[model samples]
Target: MWTKYSTLRATLKLHENADISQYGRLIAFLKNGSKNHKPKKAKVLEREHIQQFLVEAPNTKFSMMKVALLFGV
Candidate 1:
């Protein structure tokens, strides 16, 4: 959504010569407003789950995916 907003702003600036300064208050609100803000709870993986993943990931065809997941985690 923020990306779309930035694209629109850029397009308007480049093609329409829009007066985007008039939208400063709106941009500020979108950036700092609490209305749509929600904290996501982190999901905890059990020891058994991690062990099973380690055992099974190597048997799959997605070897690169397994490597990426290992590094990412």
Candidate 2:
């Protein structure tokens, strides 16, 4: 919707020489209407999972990533 609105706005400005400032209120409304997105929570590894991962990680193809995973966890 925002993309379509932007395209329509650009078309009007280019073809009709319309002043976009007239739609300030509508723009504000559209901006506020799209702010309902919620952020996702980060997943945490369990202590047992971490222990098992450390135990088996050394021999895996991704062994080099163990240090990075340890720091990230």
Candidate 3:
């Protein structure tokens, strides 16, 4: 059974996809959402990717690479 637990889930939804059904569900799910939240997925970074991102990254602190991956470079 692959049923979703509507009770224990956090109410954090975004209008990422333009689908009507998805957008409506997202609205219901995040109707009572909080400000502080974290995404479930973790970004994976390779040395090669970082090297490429560094070239186009702006500023020393917030670079394109840093924003690209949710994690660190």
Which 10 successive residues of model 2 have the least lDDT summed?
A: 57-66
Give Cα-based local distance difference scores for all models.
0.76, 0.80, 0.52
- List RMSD in Å for every model shown: 4.5, 6.7, 14.0
Residue pairs in clash, model 2: none
Q: Candidate 3 on 1-73: residue-level lDDT in tens? A: 0023342232222333233344566656665453445558988878888777666666686665466664654
Question: In model 2, what is the error at residue 4, expressed in angstroms?
Answer: 1.1
Give the per-residue lDDT digits (tens) of candidate 2, residues 1-73: 5877889889999999996758788889888988996669999879998789878765567676677777884
Candidate 1: list runs displaced more than 4 Å.
1-3, 28-36, 41-52, 69-73
Writing each residue's lDDT as its tens digit, candidate 1 over 1-73 gives: 5666778888998999985647888778777764677879999989888768877765558677667767995
The top-ranked prediction according to lDDT is 2
Error of 3 at 64 (Å): 11
Q: Clash number for every model?
A: 0, 0, 0
Query: Which residue pairs clash in candidate 1?
Result: none
User: Ranking under lDDT, best-scoring first?
Assistant: 2, 1, 3
